[model samples]
Target: MGAVASQDKQATLKGSEPSVAPLMRLVEPGMARVNALILEMAGSHAKMIPDIARHLIDSGGKRLRPMLTLACAEACGYSGENHVKLAAAVEFMHTATLLHDDVVDESELRRGKPSARMLWGNQASVLVGDYLLGQAFQTMVQVGSLDALAVLSKAASVIAEGEVLQLVAAKNLATGEEQYLKVINAKTAALFSAATEVGPIIAQSTADMRRAMAEYGTQLGLAFQLVDDALDYGGSSMTLGKKVGDDFREGKVTLPIVLAARAGTTEDRTFWSRTIEHGEINDGDLERAIDILRKQGAIAATVERARSYGDKAIAALAALPAGAHRDALEEVVLYCISRVS
Candidate 1:
């Protein structure tokens, strides 16, 4: 397929996302000049943490959150070292959440490696996640931006709320769009929204501009997650670095499945409602769900929803003046929706 058509046919990421292999191309020195800061953050008390923390820390994620902060700051015309600290803080917070989530979900894997909870035991994993969160707050203090700190705190609180919401509403089978939105906003979008807004907050941008960044982040976060939900069914386990159909096994009630369950034929409904919805999913259940999702058009519908968010992200960026940084940000929107590897 041609590049544009290939992107257009991505699993559920029906819009633009920077491709994984070439994300560095979208990021310039402006986005990448903070690796040392991250190393320093991890260096403070190295030996105390041990291999578990080291394992997760070494996984080499795409670092999308930090990149958002850097690119947004540059786009908004901020030039300083503070964004580095902020980016590191966001990463720590995100990584911390992943640890806690693995423990809570009893997940065995992360980023294609043994989860912290798996390798180090649940107690160690939970404590380390806590440590990362505390360390994140400490970094915030060092930056000396109370406003930024407030943003981080709010984001953290929202994330916690989202997790709680998901747990409370996990398998109702009637999780409406509103409830799902709440879960998604808390679980994923909160940080994306916060990271993007951090740039404006750090630069002391005008209120309107700050809101624009927040909108952009919120839309991107939603799009990112919608694609993630789609990937749960269609994406490869190797590419995602976690188990395929993990959400189904966990009974997470993501959007595609939600729509699929509703649209299923009576027999299809019987199996999914009794087995998958109850988290009793077994052999071939995933294959069955994929078949139902395809038949019901749930997968494509979910991808369309993701594309809407991508469009909204681009619309949010329209207010910003044109520049390489802005163009890079726009490309990121496309790439997020297109990424498979």
Candidate 2:
């Protein structure tokens, strides 16, 4: 994208949407510690382990997952340093997932750069991912919070299961919104819930507080993923960090495609089958797909669904203590939805 176009998009993002800068500033100190710990933990005797790990970690991701952990802990009045360790662990887990996901999707780009798999080969990517997971577990063990460990461990398992579920659902026109929601809940929301919940767990907060954070994370994650799904089809590639229509090219049955397929006519369904299910794409297939999504109002419906989840996320914050952290967290949800809006 051109500088002028990027500037206009930034202006649009600043006008009505809540920026994440508040949240980033709120957790900056904890994030500094978390960043150092992440680098320390990612180290290994083998040169390739750090090499591959640093490649993706240094890539320009927002590091939102770990920041959630830090923010939640601070919001709950946590004083100890365990939250820092937990935040680093959250980042490691997220990085590992991205490594595995790139390999599975056979993706060439991540965050608008060549993916780790693309540079290091699939075998190296998978192995480095495994190494990171092991490091994450070790860091979690050091925290000495069994409950926090349990939450993250369960999330790891659910994320793996979600990936498998998505693999099964890919290219299947029969996939519905319900199943698609389930996939995102496991794949994306599980980690978010875990990342946020660990904050209250380590803070020794009340059950109500824990539940609130978990709900907030889950709803926020759903909203984030739904917005991402919509952006894949309707937004700019520069905003997405990956090429537009990647979901369509991979035949991933995201909510937008599910809604579009449901609202489409017989010929529309046939077109989806030919291009998405069968992968027999032609020169203008992507443009035609966008036309169909627009005609069926699938993109709008998906954004509405994301807005509903964003509202739920804000509601979930009612139980948390009121402060800058809480406000930042709420804004984070709005920020997620506003990318497409």
Candidate 3:
């Protein structure tokens, strides 16, 4: 699919976000090779996975996971075909998560398009997600790098854990920082850390270097998801793809709502426990949520937290030698804080 429509709106941070110009400039020959390998990874399946894969490949996500892999590989001085195969692996794992997530959340749209479940049916979507994960393992095996496989598998495990963790935490106002971190780390940061850190391992870099790059990816991933959660309440419904305030509507107690629940007035607490915590929101409940969120500064606080993670990502990059790839990584870190869609 082509790029989605962009309708401008006022925000605390909009165009002021960092540019991907540096990365854009660096998308030369090496990335082209990686892109070709991605096509190869989408192998033919007579049935089952292929049907769902077709819809998914056509659904038009930003291809951010694969792109991150390529960027990290280049940033860490990797100049090999491993980046392509590994990047495809990252995307497969991510796609699997989306497939499962839609089913779990009963979501109908993704990237403003019908979810796989909506178009293909639930069983097909779920099975295909499973197929992609299997495909990912196959992709990793082709590289013959146990180190890479180890990292990627661990990430996959964390992703699954995070999904289940979210299911458990939803509508529970008692979810605190440690629990929230557990969910996000398992759901978001794990893949990110795996994707970037794999580049170094594929390039046969030192262990310490891999550690730094992993930190960068983990922090960036956390930043990205924080903004995503914040947007669930604060951004335009259309721009957000999913419904506006869908978390509250679904009784998902994200950080913003969690903060409000923790610090709001007694009446607000009662409302939260009765409505969100109990999943009994009435018609006017969302507006009330907005009021409470604002009073608690949940939106602002979440954004600041995202920015802090972004800064940590940048700091992680300081250990790497200066280059265009590093610059691209930096741009992405900043973008995570401000992206509305």
Alpha carbon lDDT of residue 222, candidate 2? 95
lDDT of 3 by residue, 1-341 (tens): 00111112112224565555456557546556655655566566556466676567666566666777777777777777878888888888888888989988888888777888888778877887887888899999999999999999999988898998999998899999779978998899999999889988988888888999899889888888888888887887665777787788878878897788778889989999988777887889888888778778998888777777877787788777887677677777656665743
Best-to-worst lDDT order: 2, 1, 3
Per-prediction TM-score, please?
Answer: 0.90, 0.95, 0.90
- Evaluated at residue 86, the lDDT of candidate 2 is 95
Each model's Cα RMSD: 3.9, 4.9, 5.5
The candidate maximizing lDDT is 2
On residues 90-147, what C-alpha lDDT tens digit does candidate 1 reach at each position?
9889988999899888898898888877667899888878877888899999989988
Residue 171 error for model 1, in Å? 2.4
In angstroms, how far off is 224's CA in candidate 2? 0.5
List residue ranges in candidate 3 displaced over 4 A: 1-16, 28-36, 45-48
Q: Model 2 segments beyond 4 Å from truth?
A: 1-16
